[model samples]
Target: MKNLKPMLLEVNANPSMRIEHEKELSPGVFENVPSPVDEEVKVAVIRDTLRLVDPHKQKKKDRLDHDVSTAPEAGLPSLCLKQVFPKYAKQFNYLRLVDRVAALFIRFLGVKGTTKLGPTGFRTFIRNCKLSNSNFSMASVDILYIDITRRWNSVGIDHKESGMCWQAFVEAFFFLAQKKYKSLPLPEQVASLIDFCEYHLAVLDEKRLVCGRGIVERRNALVTCQTDGLQLTPAAHTPLLNRMATASKLADYRNHQY
Candidate 1:
């Protein structure tokens, strides 16, 4: 029973449960301790620490990290006007177009540092800025707006709090420019359009550019054929005769001609 008692004590022992006093009391000395203020302080400290390191909160953070890593737009850099619009890289006036758009965006919202716009705000911007005027038809403007809205929604942006960034405005502007100047050669049209809106280069996508080059090549081929007045249809292949029959025909033709 004595050995069992010592084993029970060992099993019950916890280092953290034991509190050490800074000052030791002498033998036969008794000091009246104050109210459990020190103990209360220790309990509060432990409670706060537990709250801060809650397992549930840690799990939520981990989930958020995983979502961010796996998101479709994960590796894409924040849309930058200069990087996307390389054609206007050296032009300060063109680069300032980003600032101009940003300023107007925030001004319309009446909120400082707010760079995003909801669907209604975007529509208002187009109307107020006269973006749909002149060469840009209302139908095309609506289409562009819908396209931007769909893209913005696909990224899981909450419409209640978040909206499309200013970069989308630049994209829409360039889209309209392309529509307006559809007849001109692509490079020449782009160059001419850039003079009006310095940020026109921002609309170009690498994949779209590759596809455009293919279309341009085909167009050039068609134009060449037309200029030469060549038949549009492919020439029919001549059927091959037997080798012996071909040789005899050639010999007969040679003899008859000579």
Candidate 2:
């Protein structure tokens, strides 16, 4: 038995010889030896590999959440505006500044914060503002406008106090815009117009200038239209004589006829 054990040890030391002997003695024993992989480990490896290869799946196992109140307030960045439109920034009044910022923010809410504003888009924006935030006493238009104006002035875009009528305000803005952006790129011009339109509506609201009321009031004034003649008719028309003072030529015509 001792001699047999020594021979077996010698055979086991040579792995090739031992395997051949084992196969001949018990071929089925190796066949039933269980696989080394744990099922849970295999499943986890496959899941990880799949996440890397598949573009549709997100690699990050967790997502971040943001609260609305935590997000910064959206508005025209005066510093950016000053750089973008230097001339307008320097000359724009406080009221004009307020209009532009409020209009752009309010209008953005109308289109879910995308797309260009339309001609009558502000009318719709006013409706949306009332619905969403209403006259919440805390953040009323007056308070908001004041805040915006102060910020704009701080950025060196010095605000002038001009309670000018809405028409004059709009005319002055467009004039400066034309001069400033005439040679600039198309994108800058379009952006200015968009901002200007928003500002226009805001100034009107703040000033309480009604387009319809202004038109009606002007139409009712007799002196609103210019004239040059006695009855104050249009200057382009023939002059009006004070009276029909030219003597009749009847007597002279009668003598000539005889």
Per-prediction backbone clash count: 0, 1
Candidate 2's TM-score reads 0.18
Per-prediction TM-score: 0.31, 0.18
The top-ranked prediction according to TM-score is: 1
Per residue, candidate 1 scores C-alpha lDDT tens digits across 52-164 of 45522434656675756666546644422112335455764544554654555564563565666666766665655455666666676677777885685677555555666
What's the CA RMSD for each of the models? 24.6, 29.2
What overall lDDT, based on C-alpha atoms, would model 1 receive against the true structure? 0.57
What is the C-alpha local distance difference test score of each model? 0.57, 0.41
